[model samples]
Target chain A: MAYEKPLPQPTAIDAPYWEYLRQHELRLPRCQECGHIFFPPNKVYCPSCLSDRLEWVKLSGRGKVWSWVVFHQRYFSSFANDIPYVVAFIELEEGPRLMSTLVDCDQGEIRCDMPVEVVYDDITPEFTIPKFRPIR
Target chain B: MAQMTLYDFKDKVCFVGVGDTNYGALYRTKDPRRNQYTLGVEAFKAALDDAGLNKDEIDGLILVRIPSYQLFADMVGLRYLRAANTFRGEGRMSALAVQYAAMLICSGLCSTVAVVYGNDGRSVGATYGGEGEGSSPYDVLYGMTSPGAAVAHMWRRYMHEYGAREEHLAAVATSNRRHAGLNPKAVFRDPLTLETYLTSRYIAAPLRLYDYCLINDGAVALILTGAERARDLRKPPVYLTATATCTDLTFFYTVDDFFRDGVRRCAEAVFGASGLTHKDIQVCQIYDNFTPTVIFGLEGASFCKYGEGFQFVQNGRISLGGELPVNTSGGHTSESYMQGFGLHAENIRQLRGEAGDRQVPNCQVAMYICPAPICAAHIMTRR
Candidate 1:
């Protein structure tokens, strides 16, 4: 049976992140005062300096796979068909890491620190999900 | 490294007693006769009986994964408590509850404290994945929907970065199972072999069935009093040398660095206050919610280099007869998964020389580590 995985419910702290993912651009919040760039797209004060001034800076959409796991068991009914799919932790060029799935490649090809580029998956009508594909 | 102000204040308290019902096998599934409160009270009662004290003696109550503090207090016949609180979490809160009780004692707010923990996640069929409660939505949407999946990635990363293989993880599982066999109360005492571990089906590719923690119904209570008072108690006092909690909540699942900094922070404070190095620890009861977590914790506690944790476990270093034993009570994996409560209880037994077959002989200082999402640690030394 085919089913959709859970979707993100955009909160005020993270709405801009989903909005940019929908537009095929990856952006992260950077502290204007301390120059600290971070991920998960929801932040108020800088984690380093506690400054409230921040900006959503567009990323290069390139990163290295810090780590990855292949889901062999279906924790979610929606992901049953995708059993053995890979969830790769991507360390973007700008320092922050994001939890994303590997795409446009075979499962055996996933490796740590492998260079990857962001790819858009329009999994839902309202938004697009940003995943990574091994940079060929 | 900055220190939390409370770290200096923990030395006065000690864990004097640990008690639990026969979580042997009957309690793994829910029984109509018991709920969370009843189980909690049962453990609480056992602890009081073990401590040779009455319910009226406890002035502080810290409940982890239990509800109805008032009802429980009334049920346990504990009246006029100076402090009562309910804590909830994966496993971190169990050890954190110890600190909660200790801080209350340190501040002169309470004379004696009881840290009670009870869980029914298995029979209740609690999921570690999906939406709110314990999981992050980012993971719920992706296929990495469970704690096991998240930790599986951690092992994959650790292996890739440090030259570890499934064989190394097999060592961890094999050692714990061996230790569990000695523990009659352990939930799963069936012997596990490395060959079997390597062949076991994967729940999340890198994490085999052996790497996961069992979800079973159980409760563990720890009673704390002043170190001076504990020395004269029914059992040998396990002095609370130090404890610390750390969290890296900024980015995604398990946070920015797979929660390594939390473990590091906890280790610094725990070791610093004890005036003990990693070498002084005779036994280590890591919160083995998953096998890779032990790997992360070993690195955090300075037992080994960041990427060399796998190498350290090889050749029986983590086994009972080795230089340092890790999880001699089987931890959450093979032991009763009372959240992280069982790990602390096991270390206390080891320190008191009461751990029958699994005892690490000449055990003096034992370390309890809760490594992950939020890390907490305690150093308990025999007095």
Candidate 2:
């Protein structure tokens, strides 16, 4: 069956971020001026200093769960089957946070500061979502 | 040259009249025909009646959620205005309306400005979530669609950080519902105990159904004028001594610091300008879009130390007749959610001592806090 979930359609600025994910690599934009790394990867300039000198750098894909929540309400019809799934804020070792779902972990055992690492969900051939799993 | 301090406009602009739709009566009146304009006009006329002023006296108009200023002004017959504007219906814009009206009045731009808000969200089926709604498309990408989910993430961390439990979150809802029992205008007056709150299914885990605000249709209007003009009005004037706003949009709709910096900055300016500390605040109409927001508001406003918010609400500390009664009108959780419009009205009522049954004894000072990403706070005093 074709993937039936919402996927991030890569724009011109963020196409590289998605392309990197396709190759099982996690990368983000780093400011050459301020050394500030940011997410959503659609920025044309550094958020901190507005410098146009930006470079995409590979990330370690290691982080900790800052916080997590279980969704009991199905806001999207596609997510209705996953009614009680966990979505968490994973604080990367590089000092920025990203939102993703936790996999291979029991809901009852998840802790706030639990160690986690990046895992990819290639739901479709074209798109890959970077999820997190507890680093047991 | 001397600096023009924030205190320069203190007590210069005052709220002379406050009015709202029969929220409880209109609860869940999902008639699409009941639009914002009809509700706005209803509240506007009621405010005019409360102030004993004619429609002709309203020269300036500020609208929220209600789309156009020209249409609202024309419908309400507000001609010869010095200032007229509109703002999106967000929690912060409610207090910003008061700040802008104060600016217009103190700068001699306009007199007797009417700030109005009318939301038919429930009527028009505003889910406030899901695809194509107010949330970012990135939010929907992960099935994290609503504001409640973000707050749930924060509360989960809060619980882990402070060793707080669901009972702490329950304290906020039950206490607000307890106050709602005395509020004839509140929407959810049915008895809600901690047990009910605990067992209620989570919309987003850690935050249950009762933790969220109701999506009801309602309208709120407040009449503002110069202090001199307010004195001649029928009702006692509730002086808007100070107002401030601090925004934290750096984190893409989520705040890593949980709105601590924004609330503190706004609180400092409001407290310094009004010359009233937390102890002097007899009543607080803190925005309760979600129960966690109340915790953040109290903590950020310096009512308690950071991370102590869960405990600060315990054992009737925020109930009526407690050290400081919060959301005496039941707030957005129990009372009808008018975004933040109803909260501003509740503050005026508390300062005017018109909040019967749920009135805090010897109420002299009341504060309104909206602790969103773009947080705002204002202090009102009885004159």
Candidate 3:
């Protein structure tokens, strides 16, 4: 039997992000005029300055763990077996934070402000999930 | 409009009736809608009965349903009435409901109004288990299956920003459970130790089973009438001193900043209207879907300084005998989690001196601060 992985359905606003993930990069929408970076990508105008000229920019995955929790209960059945996993919000060096799971460390060992690096988990043939690991 | 003062609640509208059903884990065997309908009807009737008013007297109705299922007009038969107005949404909807009801009465649009809420997670089947059929496309795609996960994100961020630990989180659960022990209405009304909280199975990372509120089958209702009418019917009518409502663009991914500062605007507006500070409030009925939310609301409501809420709980400041006793009726943690309606009912009970064992002694002023994804707040006082 072959393992089937879940794939996130992409929309116009977030399509570029998924495309960027295919090439192993994290991309966000940056306003060409105001130089503001936005996540979960949106339409043309910059949310800050309402500028229509926005460019996609890759982010530095280096950041500190802002906060985290270890899940002992599986909210989704697909994730049941992966009990006690750590879910964290990492504040990136590029001034934006993203929510992703933390890997490569024991759940109990995870702490706030711990330096971390992004590690991609190739869960499926077409998708590689962006996760974090402690930088020691 | 000069940001209408919060003091508009003075000698305006009052809550004459309040009621709630039992709170406990609702298993899959029960129908959630039935629980909501039955409890809602009962509470509605009880409020009407308590106010010495007939159902026909109600000209406006406000309903708050979780999982965004029930509409105010549909759930309680408000549409069938020849009533003047209706409104619907989550518990925070009450703030606007009360304000609208006040305006209706003040303007001779309508007189009596009823606000109701109900839910049954144990019997009706868990609506939060999987991708909801009609959720936002963003929520469905990103595995935002339940509030537990979304709030966990905020909790993780706060923990990382501050040097707060699991122990600090443990303190919140332990204190609420201890307070729940004294209230007969609470579902998990037994003393809980910090060790028990730390070891409890995690519902979401950073949130233990104890840190999350129980999804039980229950209903709560309140009757709002002009202050003049309320003064005549009930013993010690609980006046709505102030109310405010506010909303933020809803997208967890785009709106990464989850400090709940959006809700603070509602709190400040309401508190400003009431001319009261945190100290003037003898008891506070804050919505507690998760322990961290309560902590966030405490700071947002000016009960404590920002980012210092964890320290306040650490010092036993939010307990039963603390400087400002909060959620004396066990709150969502120990009592029933009826969206945010439970907090509203508890505030009425406290202000009227009807709170039995968990009463805050000689309570005069009470505040019900609701910080749902869409926020609403109200301050109540004894008449």
**TM-scores, all models, native as reference:** 0.93, 0.98, 0.87
Q: Choose the strongest candidate by lDDT.
A: 2
Sort the predicted structures by lDDT, highest score first. 2, 1, 3
Give lDDT for model 1. 0.82
Candidate 1 lDDT over B1-383, as tens digits, reads 66656446656888887898666664445577676787888888889888888788899998888877887788888778999988875577877788878888887899889999887776677767654445666666676667787677777877876688877888888888888898888888889987789889988888888899887778889999988777778887888888888876544544434566789898998887778888889999888888888878888878887888888888889999998899998877888788888888888889889899888887889998887777888888885
Looking at model 1, the pairs that clash are none
What 10-residue stretch in candidate 2 chain B is worst by lDDT? B131-140
User: What lDDT tens digits, residue by residue, belong to model 2 across residues A1-136?
Assistant: 8767788878898999999999999999999999999977879999999999999899999999999999998788888899898888889999889889899989999999999999998978888889999998
**Each candidate's interface RMSD, rounded to one decimal?**
1.7, 1.2, 3.4
Best by DockQ: 2
Against the true structure, whose TM-score is highest? 2
lDDT-better candidate, 1 vs 2: 2
DockQ for each numbered candidate:
0.68, 0.80, 0.44
Docking class of 3: acceptable
Q: Which pairs of residues collide in model 2? A: none
Q: Rank the candidates by DockQ, best first.
A: 2, 1, 3
lDDT of 3 by residue, B253-341 (tens): 22344535756887888778778887788888777787887888787777777778889887677887888887777878888777677
Q: State in Å the error of residue B282, model 3.
A: 0.7
